[model samples]
Target: MFKSGFVSIVGRPNVGKSTLMNYIMGEKLSIVSNKPQTTRNNIQTIKTTDDYQMVFVDTPGIHKPKHKLGEYMVNSAKDSTKDVDLILFLTNPDGELGKGDSFILESLKGKQCPIFLVLNKVDEFTQDKVAETLSKYSKAFEFDEIIPISAIKGKNVDTLLKLMVDKLPEGPKYYPDDMITDVQERFVVSEIVREKALRCLRDEVPHGIAVDIIRMKKNEKGIYHIEADIICEKDSHKGIIIGKNGAVLKKIGETSRYELERFLRTKVMLKLWVKVRKEWRDNNNLLKELGYKNVK
Candidate 1:
């Protein structure tokens, strides 16, 4: 029988939800960083097999909204939980269940779909502590299953997949077997530039920056040439990104080029420019144009 269903990965910020999604999809559909709230939208990745197709919805981390953007992200995450056949509520095994996890569980109280309490990072937890940690979470909700997995180490991930497939309802495949994700190529390029900025910058510089890919083309030499802008809220931020003698911008370009080549499996000539947009995050029109729509 064919089985297809949506599974939402919801959890607190920096709980490795994106990392788990990347590992499951076997590709980097969502950007990963040490920073919290790195994902600001719902990214859908499709995994198709001979008899089952799982559409994994990788949502933004659940957090208290500090701005319009934060609110949008949180709402997107919560929205993904509703109407799904299964919800993978992930938590860090090394950390205690805090107010954030409580808040997410509280919100899912009456949801009809089955919930799976996924204790990620179990490799960091000792065998003795694992049972206690599992017991602590088991009391909070009547989860359909309690799975302890190490997403980074790929431990018990196959078991998790088998369980998820078993729970999936029988239906036709929503996408072809070779299809990977729902995000467009331009979005991928923009995210690649942003990922590079996040890796290179410190403090609040990465948070203040947004990337847009203006042009992309393949030359006669079969090399991909791309032009993108790294936008900041102020001229001072622009200066920081450009650095003295254009050193920082060059570093960003080189790093992004390497990642793009690895992802696209081809050579890439990346050109980056910094521009001051002056608090563009609060501008609804600009945010919508940049694909950051409010989730209401």
Candidate 2:
């Protein structure tokens, strides 16, 4: 008997949702950065085995919205809780019993599927702190299982995976074995550029920027030639993205090309340009164009 299901990993921004998924899938399907809100969409990563399959949905972090894009992200996260076998509420010790955690827990209340309170980053805290968090959340909500893990260190992740597989009912393999992700190659390439920008740009500038892939074509030599524009909200931010004498922009392109090469398994000749898109977050049309569509 084979079991298959979708598991939604939900949490506050920067709580290691994408990190945990990347660790479990052993593939960097979602981009990771020090910045919060780095993942803007629900990325489904398939982990298939002879006994079971887990389609892990790495949802955007749940946060208070300041713009249309933010609203769409939060809604997308909420929608992921539906029609899934389990939910992993990933959190760290510092956020234990905090208002942000409380808000997420409240929204998760009465979910039909079993909810797992996954306490991440346990390596950063003491055993007592982990116990304290577990005790508090156990009273707050009756979770199906409570597990602590260090996603970066690969601690107890195997146990988490086993438990998740056990919770799933017998079902069919929804995707082919060779496929690792649900998103298209173009979307993944665009996210690679955005990830580099998020890592290199200033804190404020990263959030104001979006990446648009203008063209991507594969030549006969199996080399990918791609063109893209990095959209920012202000002239000053554009300068920051471009950096001194285009040094920062150059770095972003080189790193992005390296990542694309690894992901696509081909040489990537990437070209980048920075453009201004003032308040694009609030513009619904631009938001949709940037892939933040309404969840329905």
Candidate 3:
């Protein structure tokens, strides 16, 4: 019988959730960074084969909320578990599992679906350490399975995919084989710009920032003319984003345009402006306007 299902990836921040999704899709359907809470939305990426289709939902890493945006992120992550066929609770094997992992596990108490404790970044750990991690989590929770994987190195990812497919029940294909993601191109573009900013800036600047696409249009020559504003929480952060003589902003634009062009498969004329929003993360209305709605 044909099999298909939704798989929700849930975990604490920076657990390689996005990396695992990208590796499965074989494309950059979700953005990744060393920063925690890098993914703010529940991104649905589709992987199809001749036999079955698996739709993977990449959620924001769960964390204690310090602002309205953070609250929305955590809710989005939790709500994604509502009807999924499987839950891939990712953990970084290089680090010790602690209260955060426990918190996520507690939240999944009533979930009826099979839960897999995926030990990611296993390439960084020794075999004994991997065995110990398996034993530790096995004792903590009665997971359906404990799978060791390296999201970066592509180790055991295919095995995990096969196991997930086996767990799926017979169902109709929800999306076409050629369709990779449900997110709009505009959203992807905004994320690309935000990823660039996150990689370029340091410290509080990246966390306190959001990218808004003000305009995106194609000219007569078929090249995309795009304009976006980088929103920051403070005026001082604005100056840092622009840098000395507009160098930093220029770099962000150059790198973003390069990637945007590759994604769009055409030339792009990109312009960026930095604006101060004065702690927009704490503002509920502003957070909603930025598309960070409370999922529940």
Candidate 4:
């Protein structure tokens, strides 16, 4: 019989949820960084075969809300847990489980589906430590299964997948075989630009930034031309992005262009512009316009 279902990957920030999803999907369907809250929205990555199709929902990290954006992210993560067939709760092996992890676990205590406790970054843990960590988490909740994995090193990831598939109920495929993710091409392009911006900028700058793809087209010569605007909240921020002699913006453009070309598998001509949106985060209308609404 075939098996298929939605599996939500929920965890504390920087615990490697996105990295695991990208590894499972065999593609970079979501962006990754050393920064926390890099993933702000729910991303669905589909892994399809002839018999089974597992739709994995990669969610924003669960954390205390510091702003409207943070609230949205936390809510997004929680929403995924309520309806999934299984919840893969990730924890960092190198760090102790703190209030944040406890908060998430308490929230999930009432969830209907089974909880799969995944200890990520196992490459950083010793065999004895891995066993001890697993025992500690097992005491927190009666998890359906506990697997130690290193999402970056591909360690025990296959075993986790096999166990997950084994528990899924019989069902038909939900998406096509070649389909990897549900996000649109425009959203992908915008996120690509945002990812580059996040990599280039530091501290609060990445947090204040959002990217919108204004135009994308292809010429007869088979070159893809794209233009996007990077929205920032302050003129000082804009100045930093633009850099002296416009060097910083140039670097962002060049780096983003290379990635876009590689993703699209074609030549890419990208133009980037930065604009000040003036405290757009606090402006509900602006936030909604930028697609940040939906938090209650």
RMSD of 4: 1.6
What digit string (tens of lDDT, one per residue) describes model 1 on residues 189-241?
88988987888777778777789788899989889999998989888888889
Per-prediction TM-score: 0.94, 0.97, 0.97, 0.95
Cα lDDT, model 4, residue 279: 76
* lDDT rank order: 2, 3, 4, 1
Model 4 misplaced stretches (Cα beyond 4 Å) = 293-296
Model 3 segments beyond 4 Å from truth?
294-296
Best by lDDT: 2
Residue-by-residue lDDT tens digits, candidate 2, 149-257:
9999989999999899889999999999988898999999999999999999888898788999999999999999999999999999999999999999999999999
Question: For model 1, what is the alpha-carbon lDDT of residue 66?
Answer: 71
What does candidate 2 score on TM? 0.97
**Pairwise lDDT winner, candidates 1 and 3:** 3
Full-model lDDT for every candidate: 0.87, 0.92, 0.91, 0.88
Better of 2 and 4 by lDDT: 2
Q: lDDT of model 3 at residue 192? A: 98
